[model samples]
Target: MRFRFVERNRGFFGRVAVAVAGAVKASVAAIGVLALSASPAAAGPTPDYGIDFAIIGDPGNRHVNFDEGRRFYPPYAHEGFTVGTVNYKYRMSRTEITVGQWLEFVNAYRPYYDGPTNAGQFTSDWIVYDNSLGRYRAISGSENFAANMGWRFAARFCNWLHNGKVMEQWAFENGAYDTSTFGRDDNGNYTDQPVRHADAKFWIPNLDEWIKAMHWDPNKNDGEGGYWRYPTSSDEAPISGPPGTGETNAGTWNFYDVGSYPHTTSPWGLLDGSGGRSEHLETLASSSGVRLTNGSDWGGLVSFDEIDRTASELPISSRSGLRLGSIVPSPPAFVALLVVGAVVAQARRR
Candidate 1:
């Protein structure tokens, strides 16, 4: 099954933009400074059942490294559970992660940038929070809460949870700075532990996968006129009246938190997969040589449909976080023996 994302351009949403040229190119000098700490322990398996997703079915690239630079189409596009060079299986969970859970990772796995209150989150300087509004607004210089977090923090968290050790070591040596005296090392480095990259233990969900999970209109071909007003279930513009309400006439209206619908679920029961944050993805080329990154962040605004973009799309800010699903291996059952006449005699001897 697949999904289609729609957008209401009447709003003045200005997403973060990246220079396509700079984004596709590899910059080693900036990577070290750009890097941040990450650590994610195994949360265990998500118990996979052989249930096929039933929703819209339709169409939809990858590259890595800097030899010729990474590139991708429909950024953040990827294949899930490949079947002989094709992604035929669904690859995602249906949920928009909570701030509390992310806080745990920030506290235990990567706590270097934990700002003022020892919350162990990003620097508050990056964004602002309105308790009354219960939402995050862009700012800078480290702050706690989901809104202040940038694409960097989200990406770091994904790496840690997936391949804890490799991603963690890279960050500690690169982005992290010593903070606590009680947790110092011989070289003054905090003894931050590392996690591994064993499959997608916990990685960001792609935009398309997210769309499939959130409000996948089964009628894309069935000929229903719903969700045509906004992206998926998002009806109202922003700041005020929720998704099902009337549009606020774009610019005159203000932007609200991602997936404010509160009930935005795709055909597979996923939440805010497309709206909340810009989801990052790793793509590969048919040549088996390069990998590229496509993202949902787009400086904050993005849509599942190519025709939904409000402004020019960029590659930067594509970094986002992810949730996980599980599949467990079942044990075989043994058959019982009918009758054993000799068993009784052996018991009497004991």
Candidate 2:
């Protein structure tokens, strides 16, 4: 009888151990599922900066003719007669880089120009951070408004994004910017142009890229396609709103919230290509080696045909901003699934 009792006790304990182990394995598998669901691969190419990009397919044979200039004025000798013929496909940001996005870059990298890093500098003049609010707010009551910054500053922002915002080094191997190309003076001021890497993941769009994305309509001109006279994707200037309203109007021509003008869109569905803040382009002026800026800003004369090639040397007060372009690969969904499977198998083995 004693032997039988001992055998029964052992069987009960063994069953309990099995049940506990099974529960543990089940718990681990559940955790793994949760991790996979929250993984970055599952989320895809969602940047922390809240910037969205639109894919631009190659629109073959689009060009602008400034020689036979349109209604406003005759073409200047400096303005090029033709611009286009970009064959490579690329992606462009859907909207200008907003003040909110700039704040994110500032907060993360804390660049040299940030007021706190240097004395006698003013933050409010550029961006205002409200500690009490616990949120970075735009000073001009337009958080969605495009950021106005210098060309060098904009270049650094692109570098920050390229390095995943972790590297302290300004230029890293396989990085976006080639620091060697950056010219510096005796005072350590950057005097020369910063050259972008040939294989950069992100960069400011060149003149051809910008024009093709903004003005080219694939179905226009009997399907042969041609560049629009204006960045509104129309030959006509956009109708503006009343004064003091800060809306799109003939008089104000002020920058509108991105995508507010539903009628204005590129062939690839990019908004705010025109009638927003002037965007810095990667193209350099041959005469001055200054970077080009395209499109007219709000509160300025609307001339889609007008190109500010000397925008790089423009004062800080100029309402110039940047838009990013890239061809980064999308996250692989299959890889995420495989990771989940592997995790489950390991848990079962244990």
**Strongest candidate by TM-score:** 2
User: What's the residue-level lDDT of 211 in candidate 2?
Assistant: 76
Against the unseen true structure, what C-alpha lDDT does each candidate score?
Answer: 0.32, 0.58
Per-prediction TM-score:
0.39, 0.66
Count clashing pairs, candidate 2: 6
What overall lDDT, based on C-alpha atoms, would model 1 receive against the true structure?
0.32
- The CA lDDT at 254 in model 1 is 37
Where is model 1 more than 4 Å wrong at Cα? 1-93, 110-152, 162-198, 214-240, 243-260, 273-275, 283-350
**Candidate 2 residue spans exceeding 4 A from truth:** 1-49, 59-62, 65-82, 111-126, 129-137, 171-174, 184-195, 242-255, 304-318, 328-350
Q: Model 2: C-alpha RMSD to truth?
A: 12.8
